[model samples]
Target: MTLEHKRPRLEIEYCTQCRWLPRATWMAQELLTTFEKELGEVARVPGTGGVFEVRLDGEGVWSRKSDAAFTDAAELKRLVRDRIAPDRTLGHSER
Candidate 1:
């Protein structure tokens, strides 16, 4: 007998860009695919949405990187709990 399970993961890809983005987008996809395959713990959860930006200037390179956090409702609440909860009192205005 056999069993299977799925783990959530970050899925970075070359989304649409302006008409002038370099060809590195395709190469970036290929390179990410190859690297992720070798690095097993890097999950590829489709639609586990996050934000990214890319600027390409060469066939095999990219620049202008940016990424933002991703969190569900529960996670978001937890992150802000210390800020909002009176008992925690680690608010941003703390000295």
Candidate 2:
């Protein structure tokens, strides 16, 4: 199998009622673009109650409620990179 099959999947769960689809999709796009070869897929999940969480292979990496803030693009990249491609450098994102 190719690396694509072996790569981890990233999921962004956002509250539809909160109108967070744009934010979720933006995060997904950033991840997919950064880790084009390291990720199996990026999915957007709809939820309610102001939910905004990022999951890697079914495990939570970032949460809005508990984390108390939305993960910025750089932080999100670092979180995902640590899980799926630990050794991969993220250039300016690392700074």
Candidate 3:
């Protein structure tokens, strides 16, 4: 029998001091809903100093400070899909 590899975990670090929970949670929800089968988990990590970063399997995928802007749901989904399920289409999310 072949072993099945586990899906990648997604971590979203947001600044609690900056009150970014809603934004972070929303993004997490979107990712979870979109990749319910492909993702292992979507963790929301509390952080400070205006932090907003997304990671997959410990690899940095996106950073708000570095990008100088928040990533929209569609763009973020595309980034995640490219990493986890490149061939899978995101339907309306792609448009």
Top candidate (TM-score) = 3
**Could you give candidate 1's per-residue lDDT for residues 1-95 as a string of tens digits?**
12233322222333233222222344334434433432223222122122232211112111224324322323322333332232543333243
Q: Candidate order by TM-score, highest to lowest?
A: 3, 2, 1
TM-score of each: 0.21, 0.92, 0.94
lDDT for residue 93 in candidate 1, whole number 0-100: 29
Ranking by lDDT: 3, 2, 1
Better of 2 and 3 by lDDT: 3
- Tens digit of per-residue lDDT, candidate 3, span 1-95: 13377888999999999999999999999999999999989999999999999999999999998898898999999999999999999999888
1-95: candidate 2 lDDT, tens digit per residue: 67556878889999999999999999999999999998889999999999999999899999998877777999989988888788999999888
lDDT of 2: 0.91
Lowest lDDT sum, 10 consecutive residues, model 1, at: 55-64
Q: How high is the CA lDDT of each candidate model?
A: 0.29, 0.91, 0.95
Model 1 lDDT on a 0 to 1 scale: 0.29
Among the numbered candidates, top lDDT falls to 3
Worst 10 residues of 3 by lDDT: 1-10
